[model samples]
Target: MNRIRVLVVDDSAVARMALSRILASSGRIEVVGAARDGAEAIKMARELRPDVITLDVEMPGMDGLKALETLAAGPWKVIMISSYTTRGAEITVKALEAGAADYLAKPSNISEIDRVSSALIEKIEAVAASTAPLRRKKRPIPPLPKACSALLIGASTGGPRAIITLFGRIKSPLPWPTAIAMHMLPGFTAPFAKHLAEKTGLPVIEVTERVIAEPGFIYVAPGGKDMLISSSGRNVHLRPDEPKATYNPSVDRLLETGAEVWGQGVIALILTGMGQDGLAGARAVRGRGGTVLVQDEESSVVWGMPRAVVSEGLAHGIMSPEEMADFLEKIRSMA
Candidate 1:
């Protein structure tokens, strides 16, 4: 296999050097070039034609967001390098919605870069392997029971963009409560929820405590904790508990608990993400006679999570974000 080509872009020379070193350390990756700022990055991207670009969120001139607008229209994929700050989280979320394939939070201590090396390398590989988003295809809406009670979504690497796209296409309020378990850091979930509310014109709240789940509202699981449905199926609880798995805000915990509560009344949608975090939960949902829909490979930034469901014959349907929205709209219409 050919080494994945990468372009590292950061205004700070130290950052650029550290990033280049990290990428170079990954034998599977090749650091083709480095850019000082967004402007230079754009020019270099055109000339270097790398497979992926690690873009810094903030730069002296023409920041990552602006450069992303240009690069997103091109052939290469982008992975945002963000500071671990509230402001950085906000901008990174925006970038994800705009078109970034994924993002990595920059650590304050340069020595700590080693700690994140594996994660960074993994993200780069995933982004480079992902296919470009394709045009939505019309499909027969998957059948659902008349008494669907909740909508649960799980995602990771490429989830933010997929989630935002799905909600943006919905023209009316959904008839069921929506719970999202997107893999994110502690400080990032709040901004992500705020952005979702602003863009989707829906009441989006990050669940930091127990709350009553209600239709027409979106509940986002807070980072570093798991959000589970209470046995009543009417309450959402935030805690770090049971059926432990690799990722906080575990999708498995959410869907497993949801299956326990709602049974066949649950509709689980697995979107673009890396790894098989949602596969086991999807199985539980399917076993309970609930619906499981996955984002089709052609429309996913990374098809890992969804592919796991499809491979296991756990998905009731495979559709793009647009199609998922249309299906939800149909359910709303029936309701």
Candidate 2:
């Protein structure tokens, strides 16, 4: 059987060794090469042609972002290793924007290294399996659906950078807050929210058990749970998810709740991911007069989520990230 080939890139010799050891520990993965800096990584990448690359955020001569820009345009899937700090998280987001598939936060200390080792292995394996090329390239302005009061986005796998890139294309703050349910594990959503706020220049918060939804902020569903929005006395409220649900932070559940409370006021964007989590929710949204749009397959790293909606004829529009932005701007123009 063919093994997953990996190239580990980092400035530190110890980190390179540690990461290589971890990858090698997994029998399914083969560490094909290691590079001390970004430049060397580029050279070695072209030579070794590994299936996946583990890139370190902080390098001496050349950094992960620079290398990512060059590699993202190429065929290889890259996962960034980032420090577990605010600054590190910000840099990691930049790497994703430049085309990273996923990220593993660097443990803060030696005692935490073992924890990160397991996570690193898991992410490496999962990311390596994704063979689809990223599709959303142009900065087409997204069209805003008419009379829409709130936006809901669902994604997994290649979702973070896609979300950041989509929001970055929007020139100004949105008229309404957006609720997002991106698949994630625990302990990552807080930093993810902070990074999204910094990237989009809009306020973002992780969803709690219950809170009133308001305009001018982005409400992100916390990892390992679901988000349900309702209306109470003219105020939109957030509530806990159903017990023993299938998908954590279930996209279908969130959209269904929005349809229940907001009816035609909700607009849904199903981005790249595996599975049909958002399709039924789109149905719910549309059944109640809401609008639903999905990312085009060519622009999506994996078109599963958006494809499901498209297959069912549930999406009002299917567009690329750039097109979505342009479409939204035009909708605002007509309004």
Candidate 3:
């Protein structure tokens, strides 16, 4: 098998060296070159034509965000290397929504470099292997029940962009509360929710504590915690209780609790992600006569989560982000 070609970009020489060494340690990856800044990275990307680029989120003279605009238009996949700071988190979220495939929080010290290296290598492989979502012909959405108490969404990987696109198309207010469980690290969800509010023109709140779930508001699960809804469907609880799941803000836990609370009034949508976190949750929703929709493979960054639901006959329909917005609008009109 051909090793995945990679270009490492960072203004700091130390960062570039560390990243290159990490990638070189992986048998499946080849560090083709390293660039000092965004301008240099862009020039090198054109010349090297690597399969993936690890871009530093902040650099002197043309940062990752600016470089991403050009890199996103290229054939190569881009991953943002971000600092574990509020500013870094905000910029990283923008990069993800803008077109970057994924992001990694830079390690604070040498002790954490090895830990970050494993995750970095894994993300690079996943991003390199991911195919662009195919655009499938729109299908007729089957009739759904008239009453939906909550709209629960689960996503990871390519979720930020997909979620933004879906919400952009939704102009009207939804009759029920919308809760989102996106796989993100702590210190990132707040900025993500802020970005969602800015882009969608909706009330977006990151759940940090128990609160009443209300209509017309988009609730985002806080990163590193699980969000659960009460059986009464009125209260939202944030807990850091689940330790077994690989991803935090557990999608399965959110969907399962949603089903328990809303029962037949639940409408769950599974978007682009890398794993089957939402499969069991979708099952719970379907078993309770609720509707489960998945983003079609042609529109997903990674098709694992949605595919798992579809393969098990759990999805009521498969639709693109725009189609999902239309479906939600139709439901709101009925309500």
Candidate 4:
């Protein structure tokens, strides 16, 4: 079998050497080349034609962000390498928005480097597998969907990775609290929430009744119940009840309640899943003057729920899972 080819780009010689060694040692991956800055990286990426690029966030000329803009115009998948500093985090976020597939935090110590390397290899493989050939070079930007305050996101199969990708694209400390209805097996929600929190730097925890809703924190609905929001003035009331619908932690139920309670303040995002679980619920959000965003058909594994909304014109925007969080932030800012 062919190995996954990787190109390491970093201004710091130590960073480039450390990252290259890690990739070279991984049995399934091969280090194609290394570059000192974005310009060299972009030139070598087109020449080496690596499956993925590990890009550093800061450099002397043509910073990682600009290099991303250039590489994004081509075919290489980019995973940003950023430090733990606030500036590094901010630039990493920008790289994501500018079209990099993912980001990894730089290690503070040798042990941390090992940990980051392991994590980076896993993400690179996942992103490479999800790539679609013959991507459109220039993406036409659509106007931002109508503004909304409350956001409801639904995902099932392949949901965990998709949700993490979504959160990474959005800004932290949002204007309104968001909730997620993920149809995962019981006992997995806590772990999944923790995983999501680590990836996005957002607070994610299993929601219990009366837990206060705060901007920037995610209230992930526990798997065994139907979850909803009950709004009284500005306070959010978490409503967890027995399954009144086909899907446990029914996404439809969540969207229906969010629309009813928040009205025009709701924005529903339907992600990849096996069935039309969130389709009817999207209509509820739309009927209430809320905006609906569906994962584009090509990007979805099953595409049932998102496709349903798109076919019915219920969705105001069609985006990849990675774009949802940033799109939500844009909608909120507009509101």
Candidate 5:
């Protein structure tokens, strides 16, 4: 089998070398070339026609944002290499919005690059495996369930864009409280909630401890913590994620507990993400006879979580974000 061809682009020779080494270590990836700036990257990308490009966020001539726009005409996948600082986060977000496929945070400590090598390899492999962009199936929208009293969602990886796509396409505020858990950097969820509010004109909230949840409001799980449903189902409480848990806002815990509280009155959604975080939780929802809709692989940035639920026969249906809005609207109409 042919390996995944990659182009490493970073201004710092040391960074380029470091990233190249990591990619080289992966048997599935082949480093075709390294570029010092975005212009050079564009040139190399055209000539070499690599499968993936690891582009730096801050380059001297034509930053990753601009390069991404120019390269958007091509089908090659671009994974941005960004710093861990605040400005870096902003640019990384912009890069993603600018058409980049994904991003990797540059740790302040160079030695730590080795720690994320496995993840780097995994992402490269995942991106390369799906050579084409996901294709959304134009399926007939299913009938509505009239009794859903709550909505819960979980996403990661390409989550910000997915959430925005979903909420923006939704035409109106929901009649039930909606909660979301997106694995994100600490301090990013506030801005995410703000973005949602600005785009959707809904009451998007960042969770605080012991907040009473009401209909027509949207609650976002705070970064670096877990938000779980209270036993009453009408209230929410925030607490630290389980000590051994890898997902800060554990989707499994949230979905399972919400299942216990709402049972058949709940609707759970698993969106674009890179792992099986929602499967265990979704099982609980499915067992309780709740509706579980998933973002189909063709519409997802990463199809991991939703794929798991669908593969396990836990999802009621899989569709694009815009279609989810129609589904919810149908639910509302029945109400």
Candidate 6:
């Protein structure tokens, strides 16, 4: 099998070398070239046509953001290599907007290279696997229907911040129930739900085994099990079941069942997360005439989940967290 070709671009010689060594250690990836700055990176990208590019946010002459725009014009995955600092976080967010796939921070101490190497390698491999092929030529979404009642949301890493941002933006008091299936530690779901409630003014609570779904309330799934929507006559219920997929509180599982219960009245939202866990489920929602909303790549902490839906043309709207709440309220009003 051919390995995934990689190119490293950084101003720091040590950083470039360290990143090169890490990629070289991975059998699945081959570091084809290394450049000291973005200008040289552009030259190497044109020549090598690498499968992926690891770029540094800060550099002399040309920076990663500029290099990303140039590289994004071509077919190549760009992962940002950043240091651990406030500026690093700010620039990394910009890199993502410029079309960088994801980011990994360099450790403050190089001696802990062994500790950081494996995690970095894993992130690179994951990005290499998901970031390509999903490059959308254009994002074409379906039209939102006049009426929607139930809403379902899914997310993973970097979800906490995104969720807070999202919940804060939900200005309309919901007229129908909302279900959230986020990938998080098992013990943290209750607190997370309460936190969301406090932050968003939405009444969020942990789903109990037999609790009936009520409008204006948010139900979060427990970490170890999958949450599904069940129908008792015309009323919907929230309950946890055995795990059926890699992620607990699997987004697909919730969406599949919710679509059945709510039908076209369901509105599914895919937020920032890792992997394509919700793509199939979002497709199901679209097929049933339900609307699917994806968090646009620019606003996401991680674009993997929303990117999956956007690439498939199943999404009805690519919205920012700030805009989603008001959008959802419109749906509520129409319903």
Give model 6's TM-score versus the native structure: 0.60
Best by lDDT: 1
- What lDDT tens digits, residue by residue, belong to model 5 across residues 159-182? 777777778877788889999988
lDDT of 2 by residue, 1-335 (tens): 88999999988888888888888988889999999999999999999999899998888888898888788876788888888666677677667666788887777663456677776776767666655655445443434556767788898767887788777777776777678988765566667788888877977888765666776678888877787776441333444544676678888988988888778878889998777899889999999998898987776766788989999989888787666666666655665
List per-prediction Cα lDDT, in the order shown.
Answer: 0.91, 0.79, 0.90, 0.75, 0.84, 0.75
User: Which tens-of-lDDT digit does each residue in 1-335 have in candidate 6?
Assistant: 88889998988787778778877887888999999989999999999999888898889899888888788777776877776665665566556545676666677775555667876676666655653344333445445577766888898755666667777877755888888898754555665676677767878877756577887878888767777887541343454445555788789988988887778988898998888989988988877778888887665646888888888888888877767776765665665
lDDT by residue (1-335, candidate 4, tens digit) is 88898999999888878888888888899999999999999889989999889998888998899899889777667888877665676666556546676667776563458776777887677666654643533344446756556778898655665776778776675667888997754555666676667777887777756566676668888767767776552444444555555567889988988888888878788987656889889999889888788887566544667877888888877888766766666676786
Q: RMSD in angstroms, all models?
A: 1.7, 4.2, 1.3, 9.8, 2.2, 8.1
**Clash counts for the predictions, in order:** 0, 16, 2, 0, 0, 0
Query: Model 1: clashing residue pairs?
Result: none
> Candidate 3, TM-score vs. the true structure?
0.97
Query: Which residue segments of model 3 deviate by more than 4 Å?
Result: 133-135
Clash pairs for candidate 6: none
Candidate 2 vs candidate 3: which has greater TM-score?
A: 3
The list of candidate 6 runs beyond 4 A from truth reads 1-144, 233-244
Ranking by lDDT: 1, 3, 5, 2, 6, 4
- Provide the TM-score for each candidate, comma-separated: 0.96, 0.78, 0.97, 0.57, 0.91, 0.60
* Model 3 Cα shift for residue 61 (angstroms): 0.5
In the predicted model 5, the residue pairs found to clash are none
Clashes of 6: 0
Q: After superposition, how far is residue 322 of candidate 4 from its true place, in Å?
A: 2.7
